[model samples]
Target: MLMMPLEIFATVATGLGAGLALIIAIGAQNALVLRQGIRGEHVGLVVLVCMLSDIVLIAAGIFGIGAVITAAPAVVVVIRLAGAAFLIGYAVLAAKRAVHPGTLHASTQTGTMSRKAALITVLTLTWLNPHVYLDTVLLLGTLANQHGELRWWFGAGAALGSVVWFSALGFGAKLLRPVFAKPGAWRVLDGLIAAVMLFLGIKMALGV
Candidate 1:
């Protein structure tokens, strides 16, 4: 009995590590979450959306839905096109901000989006993107299925990773508010985000 628990724990740990490895990378979702965290605007709601979305996707992936989705090339193509457009548009905005970062303290107030708008933005960033589907659904699903009977536990562990990661990312960004209070810092951050988003957008557009 003790060995069973230990085995499950090990499986969970593996899932957690894999999940974090995929999620911790630079992406539009992470960038938006960090921005909300720094602004302290509806951070909870954003985190909730992100965490819940990952959980749902991971669950779907583990249940074999990912395989079905992967089999449908048209669906991926449609999502890829739509997501690429959105990413490029957002990249342009980020680039604008990078060029004119404005006062960091005032940046939050310059044109603070409504909670509803932010929610929509985050949802798009998370769901409309094909890369997210490929990562969480296809890759993670394949990995979980390798566990056989223990796949659900692995999915649960991945969900836990999402929870832990978003929590840390959303809340932890506040710790950097002091540093971001400087206009130069905001400029640098937004510039980096712009570059990352642009690269991702173009890559997705090219289907590379």
Candidate 2:
């Protein structure tokens, strides 16, 4: 009566697919990760935080936590709006740096945020945002709920999948830092980040 294996594989696929979809994007989280990676910051700590946050949410979902989250519609709306606003704000910051490339500095020298602070910032931005719950918790959890006996395995699979993707991204960015150091490379990257955030913010605002 319990289809655990199917659930696990399905969940794993969902996790991997979602991770791949968003990992390479120029969103705030990825930008922070890449910045740290290039500066040779506390990458291990960042990866751990990223993965743990995901696991917590996924675990919460399997335990019916999403039902509670979904029940609070007003809270969801507020969080979504706040997240979108933050993204837009970050986008502006990125665009400003892009046009004024001289303002950009070594991430290591930027005393604005230390490695621990940076990692926490990414974790909060990622986990506290409503979109994360909607994608990983509610959607993926609901999928797992369908399997009578396989739901547990599905949840495990999804969790493992998330771990794999984020770990890779966290470590993989270091390899790209050199290529990104070419003149105007950061400008292009910042511009792309700005564009993506603007697009996502507008889409969320429009209820799209």
Highest-scoring model, lDDT: 1
lDDT of 1 by residue, 1-208 (tens): 2339888888899999999999999899999999889888899999999999999999989988888887898999999988889999999988888886662333457767689999998998898899888999999999999988888889989999999999999999999998877788878888888898899999998988
lDDT of 2: 0.70
Off by over 4 Å in 1: 1-3, 103-108
At residue 91, give the lDDT of candidate 1.
90
Clashing pairs in 1: none
Q: Give the per-residue lDDT of model 2 (tens digit) for 81-121.
A: 88788778777987887888767654435434576677667
What TM-score, computed on C-alpha atoms, does each candidate reach? 0.94, 0.82
lDDT of 2 at 118: 74
Q: What local lDDT does model 2 show for residue 191?
A: 86
